[model samples]
Target: MKVLQINSTVNSGSTGRIAEDIGHFLLQQGHESYVAYGHGNRPSSSRLFKVGNEWDRRMHGLKSRLFDHHGLGSVKATKNFIRQVEVLQPDLIHLHNIHGYYMNIHGLFEFLGAAGIPVVWTLHDCWPFTGHCTYFDRYACDKWQQECHHCPNIHGYPQSWLIDNSRSNYRVKNQIFNAVRVMTIVTPSQWLANHVKQSFLKTYPVEVIHNGVNTDVFKPLDAPGAGGRYALNAQNYVLGVANVWDTRKGLGDFIRLRGKLDASIALLLVGLTRQQTDGLPKGITGVPRTESVEDLASLYAGAGAFVNPTYIDNFPTTNLEALACGTPVVTYNTGGSPEAVEKGVGYVVEKGDVDGLALAVRRVLVQGAAFRVNCRLKAENFYDKNDRLQDYLALYKRLCAVASHQTVYDGLQN
Candidate 1:
């Protein structure tokens, strides 16, 4: 069977790693799989569409969805892709965060639905069902519940001056998505799966498939040098990672907890600007982001506990990484993040429970050595890399079977 996977990006971070993992796994299994989307133009046995080097051009390409819900752009580009896909002729189309700057959503999904193809949409966020926002909780708005007339984040990323473009997006997406025969929704956590049920996309079957981490690169490290490199003794630190200072990720809550921490403790953060670092309280240290998985694994092993003060999350990779490195986690009870922490792995505090977070940190850092082992055990039980990948493979096959069976039934009735 042939498979086509689409995502906005396949590089730079965990999202990329995820796309790569699935593609490589399928390749080894002797199944033909290809990837589509921007930022991953690498010559894989599976890359169906190779986008050019122009970032702005790639972004502008997505605007074609607004023109007509049936295939974006001139016949030339659409024909080229359609021709390529015809040659590949995949049995299944798996989507992951396809809104970035990759292939045309309206064009591609419309085609897939019309062909009565099976579709497995692995939602990394709540983008597919919503009008526009990838993450609306950051804006604290619920216009998505009705119609997205006046968007709260118009001036934000993927800016649109036109009002109610969300309504159009919703219309186009619904028209196309409804035509899909087998739409399997895959969320990273049960918390997100539950949220999917509340959205306009509740019709499709939803499954929780926790993202897995490669433990070979993320296992516990014995080097005390990483501790000194970050200016700490063994087990003398805490770590946090995020793309930016998003309110939903709860940066402010972490800052408040930082203020109450002991002067001896240091909160090291990656993926923040110098200004963000300077704005942090006296004891918190800011480390530049490391793109290497091995480096991050060492960072986790060196830290006492990974602290996630995020107000909301689907399922944070930091929680998994900390556990993979034999480090505990202290995260909020909001969203699916707390579910990942589970029992014996770490502490789960209510949103803004700075006191509880700080206490969890001290317990793991100064005295909870045995408790940290529980974190590693939890990773093996729930997030083992092989198990997570296998789940996707099974889901893909199941979706394909359902899609095929539906096609035969409809053909017979006609």
Candidate 2:
């Protein structure tokens, strides 16, 4: 079988890695796998295709900034990509994060509507349904459930400096997205699937497939030196990590939690910008993002507890990584963050509850060795990378089978 996966990036961030893992799984199963990406170059085991040039990305960004027309620009890029798709004639097309200043959504969907190819779209965020924002929970906006007009998150990601074209964007998406005849939506968490059912895209089937982590790479490490390198004790530090630390990721909440934490315990944050690290308060130690998975695993293993206070998110992979590394997690009860924390594995506190976060960290510290076994067990049982990759492969086979049956039935009818 030939499978083509399209995403914003290759083997990079969470979504990119998911795409890469799925590609690798297909290749291992003796199937042809191809990955077409729009941003970032990363090593992958599958055939690689670059969707558009840097100039196209720049023009798309500019269009989004001036007109609030993200996903609608890059018309030529989308046309070129569609031509490539025709040549490949893939048995299946799997989509992920297609809105990162890359392909034109209208042209892509129009082709899908006519081509009669099966599509599986894994929504990493709320961007596909909403007109403006990738996430609406932070602002308590329900405009996406009806019609998006005068978007509250106009200044957020895919930010627009000039226009408010959300109403039209919503209408266009509502029309084009539903036009596809053979498509399925996948969300990493049930929280997101429920929201998809509420949106205009409710007509299509939705599946919840939680993101997974590589236990072999993320499992507990015996690096005794990991603590000394960060000036933290082996089991006396509270850790937080993100690809980028910002207000949404709860950088400020960590700063506030520092005051409530005991002086003996240390606070460490990974994935901070140089400026962010420099501006951090005295008690919190900030480290820039590390590309080495080994280094990240060691940090997770050494921590007493992992805290994720994100205000808006859909199933963060960090929580699974921490659990895989035998570190208990303490996360805000926001979106799908709490879903990773099964009972006895971690604690879930309300968003912005710094006091509750600090208390949970203290409890983890006290429980210490007790939670480690449960954390690791939870990860191995439910969040293992191989198991989740197999899930995708199973879905692909089922979808292709259904498509094949429908084609045969149509032929018989004719």
lDDT of 2 at 206: 98
lDDT of 1 by residue, 73-100 (tens): 3334444566677777789888887665
The residue ranges of model 2 lying beyond 4 angstroms of the native Cα positions read 223-225
Q: What's the TM-score of every candidate structure? A: 0.87, 0.97
Candidate 2 global TM-score: 0.97
RMSD of each: 3.5, 1.2
Model 1 ranges with Cα > 4 A deviation? 40-48, 52-80, 138-146, 155-157, 161-164, 245-248, 274-282, 406-414
Error of 1 at 379 (Å): 0.6
| lDDT, each prediction | 0.73, 0.91
Give the distance in Å from residue 20's predicted Cα in candidate 2 to where it truly belongs.
Answer: 0.9
**Per the 3 Å backbone cut-off, how many clashing residue pairs does candidate 1 have?**
2
RMSD of 1: 3.5
